[model samples]
Target: MLAEERMAIILEIINEQKAVKLSQLCEMLDASISTVRRDINSLADMGKIVKVHGGAMALDDNFSFIEHNVEEKLALFTEEKIAIAKYAASLIEYGDFVYIDAGTTTEKMIDFIPQKDVSFVTNGFTHAKKLAQRGFKVYIPGGEVKFVTEAIIGAECVMTLKSYNFTKCFIGANGISVSAGFSTPDVREARVKTAAIDGSRKAYVLSDHSKFDKITSATFIPLNRATIITDKLLDKKYTEYTSVKEVL
Candidate 1:
């Protein structure tokens, strides 16, 4: 098959599977492993997909593929995410009900959350556990656990989230684009995110500069739907919609 044909098929598979391994791609395309690697490399260069250790993932502009891996995610933009999280944590008040979405940035916020009378709801197993262990009134939306990200998502999670009304929600995205809006790789997780946004009175998206101008499949919400809390280094192109907050 032609390179273009192979690339098109690769994109199609990524859309359906959310991720694809190098070996699997070679088998599906009837191409040599080296050829598939070249295709993946080319796609990564074009920003069409993100190359992971053993495979590639759909390029979700709001969040990087790195964000899906717990350890690597925690290391990336560590200082910046921590700063953003601290700022978001400051917005929470005692006795408030808050919903925290899944992402490394939102995870950082958990540590900075002040010890107070607050109820927290989440679809992220890690975040839920951390908050629950920290003495916060934490509620976990029961659902299937996506092992790749440790995110709980599905119909059950969405249903559970819909029953609660949070005073504020701090959401995270895989990618954010003016045109594509906020997106995540997993469609199920996107549904959970939408539910969280709908369940909250006010929604704030916590993202670092790296998340800007990225377009991921499965948009959960439009960029205009929520207030964005991000670092000032964000691309100037996003200045119009983003509430850029400098992390001192």
Candidate 2:
């Protein structure tokens, strides 16, 4: 397996087992002790795990959305999010109508988009304001506002999303896995994301590498529904499930 693939499995194992011995990681990844050590070190630097003397420990549960607000999350992976968002914005051509999902990473995209005639539709309160301030044509669906996420989510949002067919969609998710697909902790937001993907001709999931191999509360899209754009393509195995592009 590739280093990226090995790292992903290592994370999955650590998350499942809580703590694992170095020898166990080597046996599971089917690699040498030196190789496993290197992978553990890398994941540690990313703060994805805790490195013990002879093994690694999982970070506190990162699969929940209720724990952190957008303001806090924007600071978590700024560099990675910026890189992935820039690539997602680059895919938007003039005259294209795009749906930008409510997310910390997805919201950063507004700063990087070139001044062009592309229109935007969003459920994020912050995202809509940022896009409007940048002088882009922006639309917001009618729905009940969820203050925690600052997003419009409900039956109304889904209704508005269905009326317009988008050229492309830039989405954000709480977690993702081949088995569970794209997911978030809120079911209402999941409905909005699902509608956005279905309404767009092309769909791109923008997330940092930290999101891979994780499953959250609700599934929004299957792996095949959207192309994955991330800071790193850890596992080539991801390509077997869907299209994945690494920006950093």
Worst 10 residues of 2 by lDDT: 59-68
Model 1, C-alpha of 154: deviation from truth (Å)? 0.5
Query: Model 2, range 107-161, lDDT digits (tens) per residue?
Result: 9889989999999999998999999999999999999999877899999999999
What's the CA error at residue 26 for candidate 1, in Å?
Answer: 36
Candidate number with greatest lDDT: 2
Model 1 error, position 149 (Å) = 1.0
Candidate 2: how many backbone clashes? Answer: 1
Q: What is candidate 1's CA lDDT for residue 199?
A: 87
RMSD values for the candidates in order, in angstroms, are 8.7, 11.9
| TM-score against native, each model | 0.72, 0.74
TM-score of 2: 0.74
